[model samples]
Target: CNAFSEIHGLTPCYTLNGSVLKDASDTISLDLCSCDFNADGYRLPTEAEWEYAARKTISGMQSGLTASGQVDKYGKEDTSIPEEEVSWSASNAHGSHKVGTAGSPFTEDAPPVAGSGNPNGMGLFDMSGNVCEFVWDWSGRYIESEPGERASGPEAGSERVSRGGSWSEYTPFIYAGDRYSYDPNECYNYLGFRFVRTVK
Candidate 1:
């Protein structure tokens, strides 16, 4: 949509409108098809991809890893650092800020400007907080077994899964491992998404 282009200078021809396909919205239409790496376009990330990136360990970006070999599940896994330092929650922000603005005593009701909050081990910002991101999976229970390479969720479901807590939610809901779901056609002010593409 124009939001991505206006904010990040990247644009996709598709939007949420149901103009591309019959009897389905844009998100649902795209969800019906498997991702093609040869195609030059944006797509949503799978649930596994989102969590791995959120929990990954990058040398120079973040240090949430412990001696026990446990990586940070949330962006603020290190107890030594205050939660306000890495996340925007009720403790600091009563509402969303810009995208990446950093400071103490956050009282604004706006999302932070991008890349302003704590970057995760993958050097990606706002992986734990900001706005909950929608993934390309249907809502379902987790299976303990490995899902093979590039695993996705069930083929059909009533609700789509969203990960990461939003700016309007509390701290408990904003963890990297936390998940929620909503109707595919529903839209909220606190809801947003990120785009992913595979290299050929």
Candidate 2:
């Protein structure tokens, strides 16, 4: 990502006020950051950034936090929109699908389902479920950051943090705050990424 951003230096690969991330296709997440906030190029989002953005996907309306102030019989809340409408999960997807395509596993040639993918409330797509996204944090216990400070993760670790569940996951795994970790050197179909650049 840094290399890509560096290659596009000054003329950023993304536009701050446009559909900056709309055109992103396949991404390769490299394990390289104590969560760099001072870099001059694009980078992976911090875990906090990833979670906050994913949570905004529901905009609190379909979040099952509706004003009926109701809770399910299981003592849990439910997401209103069908899982298939917002994500391709174990219930709806047999394998990884093209990003931004909802309802079924998508192909490059398949036209996108209107209103199915996302604009969330944030105009971001596939934030809930697609592939689990790599974030710039080494696997370690959470450490709170003081106001105005960034939470740099561990100095080093055997694994890296990943957020947002994938098509292979069940509904619970799709929760915005859900997270998992994996060996940085290992590979899996469900592991993927999203890139970001701090707006100048």
Candidate 3:
């Protein structure tokens, strides 16, 4: 994996110390690896957490119209801004531009951060575009359940869940609620990830 420490000073040092399954037939087995949740290590956020962080609200903006009648500096109706203003997608980006350069295209690689795009309610950057983020949940159907502190997915499954759309995708998949899946062992250019740690 490319080192991000130079770009983001907060990047942590991760050690790749796990073993991979060499037997192709064993790929479907869930016993290949085990997670120590109580251990101190970085982990992918759950699907619920990822969505919560990505979804933006009117109150989230630092400075922008909240009511329906207000107009932006551009003199356009500010009832609601398009996703292009906050997400990098095919409509705004011909190809992957820098992580945050709102509408600037052809960069063809994940940018360092969301330059001109607006951050989510949590002040997080690049949650909707740039790249799809791998989450901790395995692929499964949504269930009607009571609200909780952390909503985890099914107990086990073959494909892992990935949230947020990539620069290669259209506006629909780039929304905060969009989700997809992939084999845990597979890797792709448009697929990247973020990590979270327990505050303890």
Candidate 4:
């Protein structure tokens, strides 16, 4: 909700005299401040910010380490069942039902439905299975870069970013770091967003 408001709250200021200046004087709810304001209010999370948050310890799927005897819902070694193998999707939902209607006990043959069960490694809920979230990057193709522990993104002025698969999306695309983009002016119910703020 905060994400939606931050982007929506700051409607561009237009005037009959053609004088235009981006306004940063107004304030909306901090809950709604999901964007990055130049120096004012709030805005959507940056691509780097979003990725880091999504993959961070508090709200992401912890990978790399061996499943190390961790057993999946099916009692298989965590390593035997990769993250990709245990994810959920729209088809898994059988349509779009309310969250948590499917109960738990996510099995290998029957993983939990989208929005109907637990979240991934991240503390965040409904990340992969709820609704697709709008990101701050531009619409364009992606090429996973190489060689860095953590990278920011194009040059800061290039590209937009949206992540998380929506209620209607398939399973393969629901990974936390999956991304998409669109024109800022474009609008759609299928496309909503969440915002973040840095207190420092």
Candidate 5:
């Protein structure tokens, strides 16, 4: 993003590691925020942040923190909004389509498509479905935390955490609250990730 950084007058973001997933290892070394794995790079969103962004329990700009299974939904509860209006789950998706095109047609040579589906209240697209996302937390049972505070997940576990259902699942799995875990080495086409950054 050097050009983006240059035009924007600040480093948009730079990842020190590129596609190192196939050879990743245990999380014991960087289980939580006790250490900095990529000091100047974008990191995966924690589970809580993922859910909060989905449901938007707290408004305005707030520092990142952890939470239990409190608010878990891809978008604010809108019984009025049908799932097909914003999500691309098994109900309307044959397979993963391009980003921004919730249920719209896509072509390889076609220019990028943006805002095909309704964005969440936070103005984020394709968050509820299209692809399940890997998060930055270890897999374990939920730990209770005081209100307004974040709960750092388990110290270590055999599997990593993943959230946000994908096109392969029903609409119910597309939202938050269902925390899934998998072996870091195991990658599935339906399994993908979301990118996030905590502005200091």
Candidate 6:
């Protein structure tokens, strides 16, 4: 996570777009260097862990979905908040803000971002606003196809999970439970990520 590194003054280390998944049976000699992650017990966040931090709830997408399973802003619900309460959406943002920008829609007068409106019960900042965050899971297409109860992601390979919405879009739909996937090492100027540390 770049934010954590910036806050702690640690040099960020990562190989852009390395192997997707490494299993016990895989026999490939690739360079796995020490990025100083071991010192802090740092690593990528699991799907559940990442979702918890992003939405603070286990429900599903903040926007309601249609009968066809397509994500839309009809009858969506945020389990983190009241029956239907949302802080971030495409209509409220122009692009990713600096962080902690508060205003109904985060316009020019607002803090420049969303989450500042109020943090979820978990006290996690920017869970639904600002730049989207990434998870350790390999993009799982279906719930049944997932690895296991604690499945990190698709065991078959490399794609990472992306959550939350960007500040540039204008839709109140991409809330918790709404997930996307991207290449692990791939970095976008508008895309950044946060990490979670497991206590156990």
Query: Best-fitting candidate, measured by TM-score?
Result: 2
| Global fold similarity of model 1 (TM-score) | 0.68
lDDT, candidate 2, 1-200, per-residue tens: 63587568633333333323323332322322223365456778878777666654332522422211112333234455466666666766766666766544456577566445533445566666667788878889998899988775775677889877777744227656677888766677777888877775
Quality of model 4 by C-alpha lDDT = 0.45
Query: Which pairs clash in the backbone of model 5?
Result: 66-150, 66-151
The per-model lDDT (C-alpha) reads 0.58, 0.60, 0.58, 0.45, 0.58, 0.48
Q: For each predicted model, how many residue pairs clash, with residues at least 3 apart or on different chains?
A: 13, 0, 5, 20, 2, 13
Across 33-147, the per-residue lDDT of candidate 1 in tens digits comes to 4444333456677787787776666432232232111235553336465545555555455555555542333434554455555555566656655567788788998644464
Q: TM-score order of candidates, best first?
A: 2, 1, 5, 3, 6, 4
Q: Residues 1-200, candidate 5, lDDT per residue (tens digit)?
A: 22333454543343224312221243333332231333334556777778767655333322222111122254224455566666677777767776776635555567337776556656667767777778767888887889976565776677778876777853237655556787666777778877665466
Q: Whose lDDT is higher: candidate 5's or candidate 6's?
A: 5
State residue 88's C-alpha deviation in candidate 2, in Å: 1.3
C-alpha TM-score for every candidate: 0.68, 0.71, 0.63, 0.50, 0.67, 0.56
- Give the number of the best model, judged by lDDT: 2
Candidate 4 lDDT, tens digit per residue, 1-200? 23333466643322123422234332222212233343333446656666555544432234423211123443333455443233334545434333333324455576555555443334344444445566655455544667652333453333356666655643235555676665444455445666454444
- Model 2 stretches astray by more than 4 angstroms: 10-35, 57-78, 103-116, 169-172
Q: Global lDDT for candidate 3?
A: 0.58
- List, residue by residue over 139-169, the lDDT tens digit for candidate 3: 9997555865456688688888997777674
lDDT of 5: 0.58
Q: Which residue window of length 10 is worst by lDDT in model 3? A: 62-71
| Greater-TM-score candidate between 2 and 3 | 2
- Model 3: runs farther than 4 Å from truth? 1-31, 37-40, 56-79, 97-116, 144-149, 170-172
